[model samples]
Target: MATESTMTEARPEGKKLRANVKPAPYRIPQAPPMGWSPTGSKRREWVSRGMVGTIMFLQAVLTLRLRNSPSVGEVHTLTDYRSTPFIQGNESIYPTIVDALGITGARFFSLLCMLACTAMVYSWSRRLFNERVGLAAAFAFAVIAPTLVVGALATVDAFGLALLALATWLTIESRQGPAWPVFLAAPVAALAVVVNYSALYYLPVVTLLALLVSVRVVAPVMAAARTAPLVLVTIGMAAFTASVTSNQKMPESEDIGTLAEGTFHWLGLITGLALAGAGFYVKRARMGEVPRGYDEEPPGIGWRIMLGVILCLPPILAPVFLTLTPSVAPLWKPPLAYSALFTATMAGVGLVRIVGRHFRFPQWGIMAAVALLSIGMAQSSYEYTLWPNASRLAEVLATQVQPTGKYLASDPETINYYLKDKTKPTQWTPTSAGDPTKALKKMTFDLVVLERPFLSKADEALEAELRDSGTYRILNTVPFRLGWTRGTHEIWIANDVPVK
Candidate 1:
């Protein structure tokens, strides 16, 4: 060993230096851009985390209140329970869950999913920007009326959105190592599609965004990993859309005025802070302030997305807005859940940066705009929660209609759920089968329920028919509160039931 060392010592000093030195890695990960951390005390990170937790707590409280509200449940809430199964296969035993735990319990499962989405949004926003931005993004998403609505609903939207967000987080995180995360992303996205068909709409947009990020932040996305999911989701979405349209009933006439108002709310429903943040992001991009550890004129991939969105969204959203028609609206009319989520993420980044005086803008101006918009957003959200419920109709039905008796209703959607659980025979006639009045005349129904306050022309005729005919007698007209509005459930009983 000494002889070898002596021989080595005789070697040139330059050669020794070369031997000791290590070569650069074949695939070095990109370094975080300068100013990755926001300009603040280190405590900001902890403060942001705490704030996020508080927002989460507030969301949970709101969801619980909605759940425990006097209303039995939304008409669409329990309808989703059957869809919990996948491809109508044995893989999902979710229907049993509805039977075992009921509406509240199923909705609780969706809550867990919604919370997961919130967590993923935080992680993703934090990774792309900073903790404060993450908190802002999380706040933006949590406060969305639809987000809150889904939290209290036992629907597939929350579950599918959660998985989609998870897949997004995993795909973006691939920048750290470019190995496992990228590989797992496609499978999770696929599962999300399978879980909720709605997810299929936003998959391509998100996948494209992920591709841009993956390539810019760290090049060479795992071979076919990103593109494969997009192609599959596209094909699956088309197939599902065709199947849904083909099997479903023809569209019932809607109040175009109402749909238009709802669409307007969706377009402008984002909180004032989020809108401000999005504007700030655009402002920074225009100023060439490339701060988010990525490349190009618009600062980063996220900024580019915003630019594309601004240019593209108006064309698609305009028809729906201008026409006051649901027929012309695309699936993204309400902003597909994932699309809304990403917009919220950007808004979060924008809000934090805007509030920080990053652009030297007036603080009071920003606060005022945000406060006003936030109020508008809150109002729109409250409006969305005001669908007519069947709590009183349900109560009246229990006492008036016999368990196995024939029943028909003018607006039978919500009442169907109550009758489904309580009644033995499931041969109930609804508005879909044509005029409830004609159905009552053609076939004897033991009970007829007609909703009132603002009835359709046909519904008015039906109510008149029921009243004029001596064969039917009014059992009761129970007044019920629909959020802030008042309505009545007019229950009519046949003169005789099986006169035995």
Candidate 2:
């Protein structure tokens, strides 16, 4: 004990010893985990905005190029401007919008509509979700093959969808922020209905979305007051549209499936579920626990689940509802043709989450894939421009056949458009009352134009009937290139042609 002198030694040795002791395991600083982050820098916002603009520009250019590709099927805008209430409304709006923009051609009108839709998609998505999700949504809308084809056409579908997007944006804003925006949604909904009769189908889905937001988070009294006007206006528009267009033929139950095919599918369902699940986990993991005083966060998992259900239901119900042949036929027709923005937004969000979480792909990499896939899909249908073959056939008929006669056309819409200047010939499809065979046998046509693969399922026996009928003879069988195959049409001349 005596030998243990309490010496105050020079502390330099202690410092040297501590310095050489390998400070706290020399770990390299770990980088922050990558996932959903609500906050972003101004530079990021600018970059996203630029990307959206670039994508919209690309879509506009492509749409403008396809302006002359020909109109196939029943795009309401392609119909005669004065024939039906829907067509008249579409035509009336077209000139005003074009005049406002100072655009001279129909192509520019289509471009403008497509641009509006793209902008709405980006704006609504970004406001509701994040810039990343919004960018992805815009990218999806830009790159999808069907969206390009439909959006490029001079149809009310794009405009209708644009209005729908606007209404949706307003409704979401009203629920999340101000009460006034909900009132604005009412007028937008009415405009959507006026733009396209098919907008009726979308109304229910949107109402469901509004209810989801309003009932849960918003004040009940305020939500009710805001919602009542929207519902009433929507109903009023639907009734008015039905009354105005009562005479228009309902698209066949079978054809309705074709309209909604792109949106509602098993792949979309699977992808949606994956998206919701992944997003839920990632967000929960990042947020950990609800912060002490943080408000204005992105919607919770419950909202995500509800949204997924909303987006997925239309596609599933479309085919079934159309199959039933409801009395309100317009309501049964697949609504997604004009509601593509919503579908694309849902798809985009899911795709981005999946790519980032599952495959560990960076944002740029995901975008590259989206672009390439879109280009590939669109390019695959290069030669099969809608109605080009039909238009060319119309030209052949004008020069080759005498125009004075009742003509039976496989597709009256195309023939009508191409033959608008010729008044001598009147074209009609097989009558609505009877099968094609019976209808053709009953009525004597000067010319019968039959395209392979009958447009209507009930008209499947048309070719056989034409071949067996002794009153007619095949004058010409014109073959048109349709993608990888050639589609041939038989033009039959009545045996009782007047001798000139």
Candidate 3:
């Protein structure tokens, strides 16, 4: 009680103070959590740029190698270039190459087209998201299996996809200010279909993308105004492409599941990560939170989702659609391919968030990235370089048979290419020609070749008729098919020809 005298309580002794007082409980100094901050680091910037340069360089080298390599099945088809419109473009450019270098060597054009596609992938992703996303998107395009094959495969699809990318980039650029792109875009869509009939399938996607993009940037009336021309132009192109290829025989299609799986199943880690990135964005939106620490602002998301959906659906649905055999048969055949541009960009986003944002376990993110690249490298070697080297097969044929009677095989274009000097273009007919059994009976074909595990019920029927009719004898059977394609190839010669 006496101590209640207003003397400040005497300070406790050191031991007592220690007993009562808590040490600044094993704490880190109060500071911002340390993480990667490359924003101002020139070294980091240069290192990233270096990586991108290396990737593009490697891709260029690979495509160039394929350009000079052996011809695969459909590669020879590009040699015709007759069905290809834009006579000025195709006739002017490709003939010189075909004359100087054989069809395989002429694949340089496809390489150029693919390079344009890859460059566009980077630019579109950068504009849509950020530079990191752009780098990642380009990397995905480089390593993904389809791209590995398509990049150098001598087909018109690559060229069409390149134009699609350019048109898309222009449309995206319009978000900033210019309205002239839509006018250019409308004509571009038509031009794409004209050049590669396969491009017709993408018209709907272009229209929808334009409408969504326009809505995001301007008022509804202006958006409609911008989109109307695109819609009209796309419809006209679609009609024109159908009319042009109406007489064309369609390729046999796989089951619905097969078509869908062909694309997404092979996609592996990149696709899963892309989908997860999309889901994450949706989740964060639902929770009313913004992503933290994003280095660059992303563009409006609605159009991007529209883009991804459109790119994915055609690969899955085209099989079913082609089976219906619409009155206006599109010359473009199955697996009408599209760039998974949006998917690739999303994959880039997923990898970035995991490695940079989730510092607790960036190792896992790194591992996924490694796995994607590894799969791509493995697939690159898993050649689609069609079986039965056409040149070797031709050599075999020259020994057993006379030059230039009607030649029938699964890939007419391939046979035609190897036999160009020996045979006339009209002398070759595709195995898919209807009721070819009647022609076999007429001995209309001097030499017939059939691939076993037949491409269609019709082919199987034709083979049966050939065996039962006894009009032809087996000349040689070569084992040339491998890797997902089945073939114990059969060669038939009219029985009258004396065996050498």
For each candidate in turn, the TM-score is: 0.73, 0.70, 0.71
lDDT of 2 by residue, 422-487 (tens): 733244553332565655676556677887645565545666777787777777777776555667
Count of clashes, each model: 1, 1, 0
Tell me the whole-model lDDT of each prediction, alpha carbons only. Answer: 0.59, 0.59, 0.61
Worst ten in a row by lDDT for model 3: 326-335
Candidate 3 colliding pairs, count: 0
Per-residue lDDT of candidate 1, residues 20-61 (tens digit): 557666878788566444454568767877888887887677
User: In model 1, what lDDT does residue 458 have?
Assistant: 72
Which digits, one per residue and each the tens of the lDDT, describe model 3 over residues 224-339? 88878778988787677666556655444455665455555456466777776665554432111223453434444564565556544544455554343221111222123353
Worst 10 residues of 2 by lDDT: 325-334
Clashing pairs in 3: none
Which regions of candidate 2 deviate over 4 angstroms? Answer: 1-42, 61-108, 208-218, 241-249, 255-304, 320-339, 355-360, 363-388, 401-406, 424-447, 454-475, 493-500
Segments of candidate 1 deviating more than 4 angstroms: 1-46, 67-97, 217-226, 240-247, 250-261, 269-279, 282-336, 358-385, 411-413, 419-422, 425-427, 435-443, 496-500
Q: Compute the lDDT of residue 321 as modeled in candidate 2.
A: 42
